[model samples]
Target: MRKKIQIVRHVVQLIFFILLVLVVVGTVCSFQIGGFQFTEPLGAIQVLMGGSIFFTPEKLYILLATSAILVTVTVLIGRAWCAWACPVMTFNEFIEYIMKRLRYKPVAERGKKKIELGEVRFATLAGVVAAAGISKTPAWCNVCPIGAICRTRSSGLLVAGAEMLILGVVFSANMYEKRFFCKYLCPVGGLLILLGKISSLIIPRASEKCTGCKACEYICPEGIPLFRNPDMSKCTKCLVCYSNCPYGAVKIDVI
Candidate 1:
């Protein structure tokens, strides 16, 4: 029964990943065919910061309010977006799939050992701060491929640049490690880590059942060792650990 559940979850994750890629491709094609102008929606924060004002103040206010609500929810729900929603992450997984099929595993069983807070994370934050200080708009969001891809149908040049940049980085990372983007870059993942600390939902360990076989650790895509810290910041809460656990030791709960 447990194996069946794991298989189903894996299949669902793969399907969602494929759908996200299709959405990006279709949106870009539609824009090319329709000749629509790319208009970005403005948030209150963006307006206050003196960034590009694509939308009215009223709309920006609404956007800000919506962002606040979403951030609040994220603080309570772990990085659900990373696990089940983010198209970039989904595409990353698809890339992993390609590597796997070719028997060229991008991730290793031993897991990549590294500290949670490192120079890369600090540099990323510093860049965000500099951008925010200089411009009303957050530079991180401007460079986000997810937003770029979603708007590809309208903003051909911008989308092309974004895709080219992301693909270059992704390919380079794959040449080194499986998910270097999620590990060292990704401003969104950084924000999600901050939210994850207060998340209502978490992956917990069943100490009684765990035999310390480390199967879950070996299979974890994020390099999280469940035995060390079940609530590691990098965990996407995809439930892959729970599904792969030979002892069924990992579980999810509202904390």
Candidate 2:
């Protein structure tokens, strides 16, 4: 079942990445299909912050409504969006594959962390909000990799150049540490991490007969020791531990 879930997740990721490409090519409109429009949580927050330091109640209410669906999902399933549908995550996996084929190793192995850099994502979130409020523009979106691909077509190559540079830096950093942006610097990820802390579904727990081996911890993209008092907020719900556990001690509890 775990292997099946992994296969299903890969398929979902591919489908979403294709949809993202369609948005880039003008084949599909972003955040909308037919009469139903949707807003990603970060985009909605930026809309509220970019206009004014003191936002109007109407604007707040409308953006809140538009962002509600995504927020609700985050609270239910943790960062399943990052694990299952993020275009960047698909790209990250592609990079991982290339690195593997090349036999390249990341600068640091997974479990050597001295500090939790994942918390830096919160600072990144604050920075994006501050940038919007100060510039009175959603300036971060101009360079955000997720939105940048879709924006480049309309914004022209000059603008796309800068966006790609940002994307390049983020992707290149993954060579130093896997999913570096997802772990440390993605504002959207930070927002989702915050929301996912309260997720009411898909909790992982270590079962009896589990040894103190750090296999699960070392394999986690976010470096969470899912087998040893895992921090669910930082968990992307990738289930690497559950799928790869040698002792079959990682039990996923759905509540």
Candidate 3:
């Protein structure tokens, strides 16, 4: 049952990533299909930070609405958006996949300190909000890789050059850290992590079924300790531990 859930999750993640590509391109080109629009649900942070460089004040309400919806969803479902549908997560996961294929996990993950860099994200979130408040600009948006991609089609190679340089740094960091940006530096993820603490959803565990093997701990991307009472706020809801457990020990349920 857990295996089926994991497989379905991967399929959904792939489809969502493809759709995100379309949205990024469609948003830039003003492309649309039969009354449907793709760029509407994303860029919540840039919008919250007083709009992106390309964003006009005319659509300021739309940006605020998107950020509100993101908050609402986080309250309802924890980090479900970050775990599955986020474009940044899609890119980070792709890098992690490549690294995993190179047999990176067995060496780097063992005995490594859990990467709980929430403080870094908090500091970044403070910077974005403060910088935006003072300058009336989405300061972080200037360096956002996905934002650069969205604007490059209309704005030109100047944006893409900066985007590529940032992407190189992010992807290279993932070679050692694994989901480096999402774990440490994503400002929006910091917001989600904060709100998700109050989220009622949780990954339930049946302690009776657990052995001391610690397989679940080894599999979690965020270094979440599955056998222990894991912190739901930090958990991406990736369910890797639940799916990998040889025993039917790690049951997922809501609180």
For all candidates, the clash counts are: 4, 0, 0
Q: Which segments of candidate 3 are over 4 A away from where they belong?
A: 23-60, 104-118, 149-159, 202-206
- Candidate 3 TM-score, true structure as reference: 0.78
* Candidate with better TM-score, 1 vs 2: 2
How well does candidate 1 score on lDDT at residue 223? Answer: 63
Model 2, position 144: C-alpha lDDT score: 82
Report lDDT (CA) for all predictions: 0.60, 0.77, 0.67
Clashing pairs in 3: none
Which of 2 and 3 is the better model by TM-score? Answer: 2
TM-score of each: 0.73, 0.87, 0.78
Model 2 misses residue 175 by how many Å?
Answer: 1.4
| lDDT score, candidate 3 | 0.67
What overall lDDT, based on C-alpha atoms, would model 2 receive against the true structure? 0.77
* Residue pairs in clash, model 2: none
What TM-score does structure 1 among the candidates reach?
0.73
Residue-by-residue lDDT tens digits, candidate 1, 1-255? 656765665666666545544433343111121432222222223344664544576755655554565466567776666767566666677777787799885543235763454537547755665677687566556665655555544456455776668666766676466666776776666666776777656655545677778777667766677876555656777777777788788766646
